[model samples]
Target: MTVLEIEYKTLLNQDEFNRLESRLAHVKPITQTNYYFDTSDFVLKAHRMSLRIRTFSDKAELTLKIPQEVGNVEHNQTLLLPEAKEAIKTAILPNGEIKTLLVQKGIPLEELLVLGHLTTIRRESQTSIGLLALDYNQYAGLKDYELELEVLDAEKGKIDFDNFLEQHNIDFKYAKSKVARFTSTLKKNDQ
Candidate 1:
């Protein structure tokens, strides 16, 4: 299905977020994760390969990401490092179809004051797999997980997402549909 939406990020210091959440009825700890896979021979020519290290959440997390060439509007796969400041990402196909993958859902305007970093994964153009896990840190935070398979045909296979999870050491009974929903509650509190 085609997807279109905006993503929001709030970068408040612990104290600031606490002060903000205090006014709200409920405040909770949340966890989010994103996994990226590169196609074979992935190369971006716009800039030389460079490395940058970022620290956020008051030494809570750290990440390293690199940037490359300008993106191809057709058949391009892209993802943003969690540290990147509320940025926009899209994938384009050769047939002139465009899609946005990473979007900001809500922006923490009054509480946040930090710069985010961005990075691109590169590999040879081929089929690849990826997954995203969100808000798994808390006891009540539902653990969301999705696996992406670079199948030659989207049809033609009886791929079982649950079975696949079992094979990969994921206990399905503990999994949830979307971790974002719990954060959605946090967003509600933000409102």
Candidate 2:
């Protein structure tokens, strides 16, 4: 499955996170574990692409995100329970759209490795503006909160995200994608 996504993100401080969580207290969060994969040399990073197997509850999805002019093109495949477990344990991606795309990009399948994993407690709500998600993520001994808006239009979404923060008197903080943050933290820890 290919999903065309336009997403905007902002970092949230602890206070902001709590405040928003209170506002959305009616929504429930699902626990998700994300296993990131890359070549030893990080060829995927050089290509500005990422591959991950995300498991929430008993379901797992293998997703490859490729940057686009607007947002990203996500190639997602549903993985059976056993396939997901085997892929994570062996650090190999099962044959699917993601693998084919990676091979096309010249990433060596043999060199691919499981970099690390991140766990996120994520709550989502559908707003008039877009689909809003509040995430508390833990990885590499680090924890952070973020607000993400997934919309169909990038420009409008940006405007809406900025305005939402401004309306709530929240300062916009820079945030990297979960993969970037997780990989960077893991690299520093390895050093």
- The candidate that wins on lDDT is 2
Q: Per-residue alpha-carbon lDDT of model 1 for 1-191, expressed as tens digits?
A: 22221111122233433343344324333333332211122221112211112223332221112222321112222333432323212211111111122112122212222211222111111122222111212213332222222332223211443344445444333322122333244446558
Residue-level lDDT of model 2, residues 40-142, one tens digit each, is 8898999999999998788899999999988889999999878998999998889988888888888888898999899999999999999999999999888
| Steric clash pairs (candidate 2) | none
Candidate 2 matches the true fold with a TM-score of 0.97
Q: What lDDT score belongs to each candidate, Candidate 1 first?
A: 0.25, 0.91
Candidate 1 global CA lDDT score: 0.25
